[model samples]
Target chain A: MNLLTDLIFDYTLRNIALGAAVLGIVSGMLGSFAVLRRQGLLGDTLAHAALPGICIAYLLTGSKSPLVLFLGAAISGWVATLVLLRIVRETRIKEDSALGVVLSVFFGVGIMLLTFILKHNDANQAGLDKFLFGQAATVTAEDVNTMTILGVFALLVVAVLYKEFKIMTFDPNFAASLGFNDRWLGVILTSLIVVAVVIGLRTVGVVLMSAMLVGPAVAARQWTNRLEAMVLLAGFFGALSGVAGALISVSEANLPTGPMVILSLTVIVIISLLFAPQRGILWDIKRFSKA
Target chain B: MEIVITGILISVACALLGTFLILRKMAMMSDAISHAILPGLVAGYFFAKGPDLFAGFLGALVAALVTVTLVEALKNTQRVGGESAIGIVFPAMFALGTFLVARFFENVHLDTDAVLFGNIEFVAFDRLFIGDVDFGPQSYYVAGALCLINLLFITVFYKELKLATFDAGLAATLGFSPFFIHYALMALVSVTSVGAFTSVGAVLVVALMIVPAAAAYLLTDKLPMMIGLAAGIGALSAVLGYGLALAIDSSVAGAIVSVAGAFFFAAMLFSPSHGLIAKARRIERQRVQIGLEALLVHLLNHEGEEGEAHESEMLHLSSELRWLPQFAQQIVGVAANRGLVMQLHGHLILTDNGRRQGQQLMVH
Candidate 1:
């Protein structure tokens, strides 16, 4: 009864829960594509890449507007993808090598830039490090609104392009023989990823954003084979973990949202991996005994 | 001095194991293992009551083993690719570790930043005292011991490692257990990574374990040479990166990675035999040689045609045969130099040797 009252009456709890739910849905939707395409670590790269963009945006605009900073982050995330692709295509370097290079180099630049800003005593830099680990209680209603609009837009694009995405992922040659333009499809897909990553970066921080992207999708994979089922299940799992994490963190003064959220996601994965009927560890054990 | 020594020790230890990791195409697993060890660190701290090296090693070793096993188990299920399995494992462990830190070890020096971007400069402060004698930074001794152990292990198991690395089936057939070697290698990698993390951080350890070996790979074909060159490259990157960080006033680990990246790109571009430039130059030379051979075959075919076709003039060759004038000139120049063809009133004529060589080329 008290929980129900807080859900409706406590503005801070309501805002945090709603915003986290939105972030979870967006990340889960896009994460399906990322994991299926075997670019699972791309989320990690983009999240880290967003830091310098946030810093540069803060320096240029002197505003803490989430919209402006997210734009900067999205742009840099796109640039990081471009560099990763170029390194793979033009050089003999492998995709993994390119990932490491971009992850470390861009993150180093961000660290250097952030340290520079702090040393200069910029008053605007107050609480900037919160982006490192994220504080859910601080999320405003305005941020929740922004998250809802962007999440819906990302989901709409995914729905509209579902056929193209399926064809492109399962068989690019067929898509290309149909003249569907693979590179353009890739750009669109990556942009969706960047949007998902940028917004979730606020709630999960740079380090844990990849978990948000990968964790739920992995859990969902144990339960289904169809893309539609996977996407829906992943979204459900993501929201469940997100809300659970928020509620858990709120129960304790010292607990943090990002880690708690991640822990919640991890629990779902373990449960799914261990007992999800056909694909579960318990199923394997049972089959082995019968055989 | 302690910092530099520690850097060198970490660099060499990582580079040694790195050679095998890169060769196995499991370089990124180092990244995975590095992040995944945090839970073990936290567990070790809580259970062992401090940052005990033995306890930390055991905790991290269990975590490392679990990480590899889970990744392989996921791969065996055929549901997730190797990369996806790796992507799913480390973050979970790292997040768990972070949560543990926030909940219990907040006031302690079990810092995530220190784990990620460890400071070599501060190693001097963590001295090992032996009966009132300062034995220098604790990390130096730990890292040096690890390097020695790595060297000795590789030396003792050199033949087995070589066979297993090059051909697992052959090694297994010959009574060397490839699975044993594989686990042994992972154990060394995990231990080395932890030792190195006190000075260079786990992320930079990945840089040391990969970039140096990859750079050396661009410069050598033999494993022995690759190992030697990789160690040298690792040491050089550490020293050079330290100087750079001092100059720039930034994180030394980051600087080390950048320097190692610099070495990788340099080797990629300019290695004498395996480099991109050398490959491009060889291809260019091959193209010209093929073009010259084609010109010879053409001249041989049109040996005596003085008809309206204007068979062998430079302009005729450029227009009729689609050869550029400069290319025709180059072919002609080569033919003339070899006494294979002669120019007669701007028309081409082949000598006996040229006709003989062309007919021999035709037969082949």
Candidate 2:
């Protein structure tokens, strides 16, 4: 009862909870496309690649405002995607190797820049490290609003291009043959995912942010074969974990919210993997035993 | 100097194993193991009541093995795709590690940021003393031992590793257990990760293991050459990275990885066998050759026809073959320069050589 009242009445708690929920919903919704397209690790790479952008944004604008940092993260992440695509297309390096290269190299540059900024300029660089592991407690009402706006914009695009995205996700060649500009559609989809990574950066940080993208979507997959249900269910699962993680982390001192949220998502994944009616492993075992 | 040596040693160890990992297409698995070992290191610390090295190493190795096993299990279930399985497991393990650190060791040296990028700057100060005798930095010995182990492992298992990597079915049929080779290689990767954990941190460990090997891969095809080149590249990155970090006053591991990335970029663009520039040139040459051949075939077919004069006129060439005006002009210029066709009075007349070449092309 006290916790519920605190969540409702407490300003910081309310902001953190709202911000986390928004991140969860956005990543969950877009991550479904990433997973279905088998680009599940792209989110991880994007999140890592966003660190350099955040540092550069600070260096360029000298502002800690979420909007500026979000823009910086989105732009750099988009560039990383372009680099990743070029490597795969132009070189013998496979997609997996390219992903590793981009993820690590971009992150290395980000770290180099971050350390340089720390050594040269001490002022206003305090909260910059928060993006590495994410501190939900620092989330403010304004940050929440920014996340909400971006999340909605991304989701709205997804909603508007729902059928096109579905076709592109499953059969991109077919989508292209149908004159859907599948390449552009793919770029749009990756851009939306970059948005999700940017929004989630403040709440889940970069390291564990991919889980927010992969877990809920994977969980949602076990329950349904349809894209629509999987996306909706993923959003719901993501929101639940986000709020739950926020509450649990806030209840205790020294508990990091990002990991807590990931832990919650992991639980959801295990449950979905074990108990979903048609696809559950237990059901398979039971059927096998009966036979 | 100690830090540079430590960096080179660790980079070599990782690159040696990384060559195989990249060949196996398990590059991201190294990334996974690197992150997943965090919880194990923390758990080892928790049980040991301090940051004991052996405890952490054991804990991390166990954690890495568990991560590999779990990913394989998940993949085997057919419920999750391999990439998705990897993407799911590592974060969960890392999150648990972060939770442990936040909960119990918040005030200790087990910082989250340090785990990501590492604190290699202080590695020089963290000397190994044996009975009052100073033995330089501890990381040097750790890295050196890992290098020796990886070198020996690769040497002993070269044939089996090669067969298993290139053709697992063949290895299996030959009574060699692919599963054993896979797990053994994974275990060494885990050990190397633990060894490099403190000096380069987790992600850079991946950067070291993958980036150098990937660059080497672009530059070579022979497995032995690839491994040597990977080690050489790894060492070069370490030296360059050390210099870069000293100049910029930043993270050494980050500098090293950035340097490694530069090397990969260079190999991608300039490698003679498989580089982008070389490939582009080859493709351009092929395109021009095809265009010239098509022009020959087109002209030969129109030769002696009722509309030969009209069809063979340079003015009508673009409309006749649907070629763009610029392309038609360039082809005509090349053909004229090569003495295959003559442009007299705006008419394209085939030369004796052109007739012979067109006849030859027609046969093919």
Candidate 3:
């Protein structure tokens, strides 16, 4: 009861919880498409690739605002995607190898730039490093507003283009034959994913942001065969973990919210994989024994 | 100087293993193992009551194997995709490590920044000693031994590794367990990553491994050549990256990886056999050659026909053969350059050589 009242009354707690839920809902929705297209690791690469953009944003603007950082992250992540595609198309390097290259090399550049900023700049650069392993406790109401606006915008775009995205995800050639301009659709989908990744960076950081994108979607997959259901369930799972992680971290003295959220999502995945009907491993074993 | 040598040795070790890794399409596995080993290092430190190296290696090895096993198990369940399993497991393990680091080791020597992107700047001061006898920088010895071990491993299992990598079914039929080779290679990768962890950090370890190996892959087809070239590229990148870091006053490991990336993009654009520029040039030359042949064949067919006048007109090349005006003009210029065609009053006339070449092309 006290915790419930605290959740309602506490200013910092309310902002953290609201911010986390928005992150969860948005990432979960975009992650469904990523997982279905077998690009689960794409989120990981994009998150790592966003580091340099964040640093550059700070360097160029001298602002730590979420909106500026998100724009910077989105632009660089989009560039990385284009480079990734060009490598795969023009060279003999495979997609997996290209992904690794972009992820690591871009991150290295980001770190180098970060160190350079630290050496040349003043103490104002202190908060910039927080993106490495984010400080969820530091997310203010203004940050929450930025996250909400971005999340809502991404969700709206996905909703408006749901049909095109569906066809493109399942049978891209068929979508092309249907005169859907599937290439542009793919670009838009990835763009939406980049937005989701940028918004989550403040809460989860780069190292663990991939989990927020991947975990709920994978868990949602075990429960349903329909894409619509999977997406909704993923959002539910994401929000559940987010709120749970926020509450638990608040209760604990030293626990960080990001890892706790990831840990919560991990438990959800374990449960879904073992117990969901029709696709569950436990169900499979039981059916085999009966047979 | 010692830092450069340490960087070279470590990069070489990573690149040597990385050649096989890229070939096996397990490049990202190196990334996963690098991050997953953090919790193990934290545990190792906790258990040993200090920063003991052997305990850390053992714990990290166990952690790496566990990660591999979990990924495999998830994949075996037939639910999670292989890359998805990797994407899921590593971050969970990394997050757990971060959680542990934040909770327990906040004031300890195991700082998160040092663990993620190593402080190679201060590595010259951390010397290795044995019974009051100074050996030198500890990372140098670690990197040197790792390079030797990886070299020996590759040498001893060269045949087995090759067969398993290219054709697993044949390797199994020939009595080599592809599974054993896979695990053995992974074990070695884990050990090498732990060795490189203190020097280059976790993320740059992936850069050193994948970038140089991938660049070498683009430049060659032969396996032995690829391995040698990967090592060479890694060493060169280390030297250049160190020089860059010195100039910029930035992270040494980051500079090294960035240099490695520059080498990769260079090779991608310029390698003779497989480079984009070379390939594009080849395609362009082929297009012109095809245009030349088509022009020859078109002119030869109408050599003595009643409609030869209209068909052999220079303007008719585009109208009849569907070639663009510029392309048709370019083809005519090339044919005239080779003395195969002549422009007589704006009409394209096939010379005797052109007729002969057309006859030859017809035979083929």
Candidate number of the best DockQ: 2
In candidate 1 the C-alpha lDDT for residue B185 amounts to 88
Q: Best by TM-score, which number?
A: 3
Candidate 2 lDDT over B233-300, as tens digits, reads 99999999999999988989889999999999999999999999999999987877777888888889
Task: Looking only at chain A, give the TM-score of model 2 against the true structure.
Answer: 0.98
Ranking by lDDT: 2, 3, 1
> How much is the lDDT of residue A279 in candidate 3?
92
Q: What would the TM-score be for candidate 1 when compared with the true structure? A: 0.89
What tens digits encode model 1's per-residue C-alpha lDDT throughout A152-173? 9999999999999988888889
Error of 2 at A157 (Å): 0.6
Q: Write the per-residue lDDT of candidate 1 for residues B1-364, one digit (tens) a residue.
A: 6777788888898889888887777777887888888898889888998878778878887888888888888888876777778877887888888888888887888777788777776888989999999877899788888889999988999999999999999999999998899889888888887777867777788778888888887789899899999999989988987787777676677777778878877887898877778878998878777766776788888766666237777898878668888877887897799898888888777789988888888899
Task: Provide the lDDT at B278 for model 3.
Answer: 98
Q: How much does each candidate deviate at the interface, measured as C-alpha RMSD after superposition?
A: 2.3, 0.8, 0.9
For model 3 chain B, the run of ten residues with the poorest summed lDDT: B106-115
Give lDDT tens digits, candidate 2, residues A69-156: 8999999999999999999888989889999999999999999999899999968689887766688889889889999999999999
- What C-alpha lDDT does candidate 3 achieve relative to the native structure? 0.89
Off by over 4 Å in 3: none
Write the residue-wise lDDT of candidate 3 on B255-341 in tens digits: 998899999999999999999999999999999999999999988888899998899887888988898999999999999999999
* TM-score result, candidate 3: 0.98
Clashes of each: 0, 0, 0
lDDT of 1 at A187: 81
Model 3: per-residue lDDT, tens digit, A73-104? 89999998888878988998888889899999
